[model samples]
Target: MHLDPFELHRPTSVDEAVRLAGELAGRFDFLAGGTDLLPNYKMHINLKPHLVALDRVSELAGHSLSRLGAMERLSRLEQDPAFVAAYPGLADALADLATPLVRASGTVGGNLLLETRCFFFNQSYFWRASLGFCLKADGDRCHVVPQKERCYATFSGDLAPPLLTLGATVEVAGPGGRRKVPLEKLYDTEGDGIRRLRLAPGELVVAVDLPDGAAGQRARYKKLRVRPSFDFPELGVAVAGRWNSAQVDELKVAVGGVETYPRRFDELTEALVGGPLSDAKVASLAEEITRRLRPVHNTFLAPDYRRRMIGIYVRRAILEAREGQGG
Candidate 1:
């Protein structure tokens, strides 16, 4: 309920932030909007001694049509008519993250790096201690899987799915220096919930680079949560592609909120790219993806129901995006 005291370091540039991170080593956390990190901190989940606040880093702050800075606020993106029109699925994600109040302070990078969550991990300090620890935080074993090897906490962020569908790339800065990587490659597919991202230690996301191929691609994002607002998604599906007449020119589907990390179905989508996609074909694609998912009972929703709805949400998203026009 209360924040334990910690040293806060404000760096005005990315280089300075990375240097500070190296100095602090494993003892620090990069604070963006603090919407995600602070809440976890208050719950006494993985408390660090130092905080590197990135608010003063002006370089990570703006958005043109082609690039979205890491520190750019969700509310700011949601309000831009041009941006929303250009990346409608991303707009849906931004608007659907938490509430307007939270979104006002929720930065893009924070949400992208949002902590994986589970019923056992996100409890009060006393409650967590009383119940014993989980692998995601203080404990060694996972309550959900009842094992010491892997954690089953679900990926609850909304932006990654839509961004993944767009074939976006991220600019990363660290002690090793700067580089860009495909958005899907940013997630560690082989890692479990406790070790989700592929980022190196002391590295931070700089910005999201929207590729030229992403331009004017029709896209849709569908999220299923406990409520229409505030609650984290139980199932989130995103579909993006361009259609030439009734034939699929390019198609990609990425799903989140139901697994350890958001992922794209490139192989499946690839097969349909050059073919004429009918309603039945879309339905089959959705069912196949749903069948492949293995969501556990980690979040509020039951895994069975979430799994069942995956087919429906994916079907709906693809159907809607196919008809919609941006290009």
Candidate 2:
């Protein structure tokens, strides 16, 4: 498969990029890493007439302990000792993302905004035509859930769960202006996979900001996928918190790959806080996660198996965090 013809625009500034996006409107798409977008384009998944490449924008490139520019390559960030030490769980997710070559081309922002995937939607044009297109791309009905109104394509990003657990916020620039929101807010909870992100037209993510205290927290990321070498996550769990002796403090848990968005379990966090990190509590938290998630048959794994693994992965992530804290 090959990429469809499109006009490519290289904008040197954020303002210029926003202007291009605004002018093009629904006919355009932002190009950051192109690791995800280009492949989808090649498969004729979603074809836009204009590509606004952010490569020339200098403002989107840099990284510190607390601030990560969206344009920074995943491979670079994963190999950086200081960055790895600062955000170990995020580094772990990055390392487990794709192969080194794909990571080299994938950026933090791209991963954060990776497209939702489904077995039926991500096929060749002929294959999709043969089966009738799904809601995400050309058709209206969702094959995953066989619903007219909702698309059940699964969220497959590996970075979002860890970043959400770390309390990261993203800076976005658009025609309106710049604003920051919690990383979790970037996703549209009520929207289907066809319209998943909350980003407005002409908006571009500038950077991701992590709290200084986030670096000191104990965290772990557990991922389940069919292939260890490289494949989208079937299920992923990320946990972060401070261990006050044997008790939990200010905990955050985020789950992904089994839902339409990476979700932070505020209810579970509230239940676990100020309590001892015991097996019973962990098991209960995992059970709650399993109860909350409803995985559809969009990925390679079976829905029931993925739902069951949610509890297992959550338990393992929390336990690993506790063990990492030397508890």
Candidate 3:
């Protein structure tokens, strides 16, 4: 696979980037670490005419415990022991994404705004041409679900779940100016999966802000993938909560790699917050989540297997997070 030539635009500031995006409109894609986009480009997936490189954008560079820049590389975050220790669940996700080499070039924004994946969508040009394409690409129908109304491509990103557990929010910039949106609302599952994120036409993610309370929570992330070193997750589960003497104070459970979006079970998790999360309760929670998710046969794992593992992984993540506090 080889990257076809395209016009590369480097913006020194956020304003410049936004201007460039407005000028280019639908003909451009923002280039972060290029770990994911480059590969797709090599396979001649969605070839945009212009590439907006964010490397020189000063507004999208920097990282602290409270805020992580959109352009921050995963390798940089993993190298910081304090950052990793503060959010162990996020650390697990960071490590689990691709491999060391890919992580070296994978940025937080790239991962958060990752493209939806499907078996029929992520193939070479010749393969997709032979199959007549899918809803996410050049065709009118979804190959995964055999439908024309909605795309069933899975949201395979791992960062969103752990970040949602931490109550993270994202800073976005557009022609209308900057605004903040909760990370949980970032992925729009209700809409046609082809649209994916909730961002406007010219908007771009600037950074992700972490809440002060998220720093001390007992958090854990568990991912199921075909290959540990390099492969997208078939299922990723994350749990974060504050425990007090066998009772739950605040709890958030998020799962990705199973559906169109990485979702938080706020209704289910909120119901058990004031009470204790016993083994039986945890098992029920797991079963309910397993029942709710709709995994398609897109990735390496079967829909049934992925659905079954949801209960197991969710239970394990919640239990391990609870055990972390030893109560």
Question: Candidate 2, TM-score vs. the true structure?
Answer: 0.97
Give the per-residue lDDT digits (tens) of candidate 3, residues 1-327: 778899999999999999999999999999999988988998888899899999999878879999999999889998998888888899889889889988888889999999989889889988998988877888778777785589888999989999999999999999999999999888896898889999999899999999888886889899999988889999999999999879999999999999989999999999999888899999999999999999988888899999999999999999999888311
* lDDT (Cα, tens digit) per residue for candidate 1, span 216-268: 78988899999886999898998889988889999999999988899899988
Clashes of each: 0, 0, 0
Worst 10 residues of 1 by lDDT: 318-327
State residue 190's C-alpha deviation in candidate 1, in Å. 1.1
Using alpha carbons, what is the TM-score of model 1? Answer: 0.98
lDDT of 2 at 313: 88
Query: Evaluated with lDDT, which candidate comes out highest?
Result: 3
For 1-327, candidate 2 gives per-residue lDDT tens digits of: 988799999999999999999899999989998999998899988899999999889999978888889998888898888888777788778879999999988998999899888899888999999977877778878776674578878889999998998889999999999999999899999865678889988899999998878886788888999999999999988888888778878788999999889999986688768878899888988998899999988889899999999999889888988877411
- Provide the overall lDDT of each model, using Cα atoms, as 2-decimal numbers: 0.90, 0.88, 0.91
